[model samples]
Target: MAEKKWPETWQEVNPGCIVFRPGSSRDYHTGTWRAERPIWDNSKCIKCGICYLFCPEGCISEDEEGYFAADLNYCKGCGICAHECWPGAIKMVGEE
Candidate 1:
């Protein structure tokens, strides 16, 4: 697949608060601004989907093995996933 291109600055975005099209936010990769990232401990995970429900960016996804994983491409690392994990399976770590 071809790599997605993103706007380099806010000036490239639509003026005002209106989005010309719905779901257009998917076109922009906003994860680059995250200062921290969430790390998942599969051994402790309960698959409750709490993290998935709480994630603002909707980046957590189920893997082929049925284990939940974070898509860093869209995850802004807001820490909500880690906080919502009842099993304490998610931890926040500084972005490398």
Candidate 2:
């Protein structure tokens, strides 16, 4: 009897359909599909983490400087981060 060999990594698996593995999506960068991008203004940011709370993708993170920054590699540019910013720190700019 022959045994099936499973893929060791997510990238090694077939890409035909969606695979529901917890935290597996982190291995793939979905930001390539974004039409617009978010730009953060540090001067206006209050470090309240409002953008981080509202981001559906959870791509926003804090930097070494104690400021919240978005991971554009995984951000879809949905603008939710910008919309939720009370201090108008995040701005959604068109991708050109």
Candidate 3:
């Protein structure tokens, strides 16, 4: 019998079936699924980097001014960053 050819990547898998792949989430744009998005209040932000550390999607990045901002392209808006922020710099707002 011939050896079975298994899918090596997420793309190779059939549609509607998600294959677990290491670091493969970056290839897909899943931010649109978010009902709410994070907004940063720089004035209240302490630049402690707490939001960046708590972001589950890893979409938060330090901007030029040293404040952490979420990349809307990949941010799922789970509100984790906002929930974890102690300074109340990050707020989750409903997406209009």
Candidate 4:
């Protein structure tokens, strides 16, 4: 019997079907379905780390200066981070 090879990247996956492989979700870009994108305003940011904590995808990260931002590659644009931001530093903008 031939061994089944697992896809190393998301592009290799068949359309409309997903193969159950360990850690396969990482290979897929879930952010492609996002209708909006999050924009961070450094001026209004308080460095409270609220956005990082509120992110459902855990895509938010802190910078060297203590500012938080999301990685758009994995961010779903759910706006949870922007909505939870106390200082309104994060804004959800429609994708063009």
Candidate 5:
């Protein structure tokens, strides 16, 4: 896969001032939700490498910053990445 570059801002803000409906599982409601982007808090990461070692598809990589990330093509959104992120650095969050 080619190197994917993220925008300078980590999380983009929603445009409209509409209120977000309560609850976490917004699986169906849609306008432009794309895929589950893996989030990381670099300070929380321990560089333990459990997520990389445990990924069934071997889709995780350690960047120069020492945090792990999943390669999207092979990540089936299994939530295993979230489960195994020991320091809570990696999480599966919806994105558009």
Candidate 6:
């Protein structure tokens, strides 16, 4: 019998999948990704589409008035959206 090896990084997991560290309170990025949560800076947002344009998961969306938001269930917490926000409306925060 062979023991299954635990993946050491995010790249080893299937895309859009993540697991928390064994004893930590919150999840951490695995394989190639360090799990990051999105923090919205509402005052800084100018309703620009930069973050929306960069989100690979298509999880962020806007209401009729164009307030941007993330649909949490589909969000993989990838920081590209946050990293690309021109006005700094979005920030990738460590899990609480």
Models 1 onward score TM values of 0.73, 0.74, 0.73, 0.75, 0.55, 0.59
For candidate 2, the lDDT comes to 0.82
Query: Model 2 compared with the native: what TM-score?
Result: 0.74
Query: Which tens-of-lDDT digit does each residue in 16-93 have in candidate 1?
Result: 745566676787788897989999999998888888888888888887776788888888888999888889999999
What lDDT does the true structure give each of the candidates? 0.82, 0.82, 0.84, 0.84, 0.65, 0.69
Residue-by-residue lDDT tens digits, candidate 6, 32-90:
24366777888898998877888876667987988788766567787888888878888
Q: Please give, for residues 17-50, the per-residue lDDT of candidate 3 as tens digits.
A: 6455667667678898999999999999999998
Per-residue lDDT of 74 in model 3 = 94
Can you write out model 2's per-residue Cα lDDT over 1-96, one digit (the tens) per residue?
122256546655546644546686676799898999999999998888888888888888988786898888898988998888989988999988
Query: What is the lDDT, from 0 to 100, of the residue 53 in candidate 6?
Result: 82
Give the lDDT ranking, best first: 3, 4, 2, 1, 6, 5
| Tens-place lDDT digits, model 5, residues 1-96 | 222243324334334533354542333333223267667677888988888898766767999978777767556566676787877887778865
Q: How good is model 3 by TM-score?
A: 0.73
Off by over 4 Å in 2: 1-22
Where is model 5 more than 4 Å wrong at Cα?
A: 1-35
Candidate scoring better on TM-score of 2 and 5: 2
Q: Where is model 4 more than 4 Å wrong at Cα?
A: 1-24
Colliding pairs, model 5:
none
RMSD after CA superposition, every candidate:
5.5, 6.2, 6.8, 6.3, 15.7, 10.5
Mark the regions of model 6 whose C-alpha exceeds 4 Å error after superposition.
Answer: 1-34
Model 4, residue 55: displacement in angstroms? Answer: 0.6
Which residue window of length 10 is worst by lDDT in model 1?
Answer: 1-10
Best-to-worst TM-score order: 4, 2, 1, 3, 6, 5
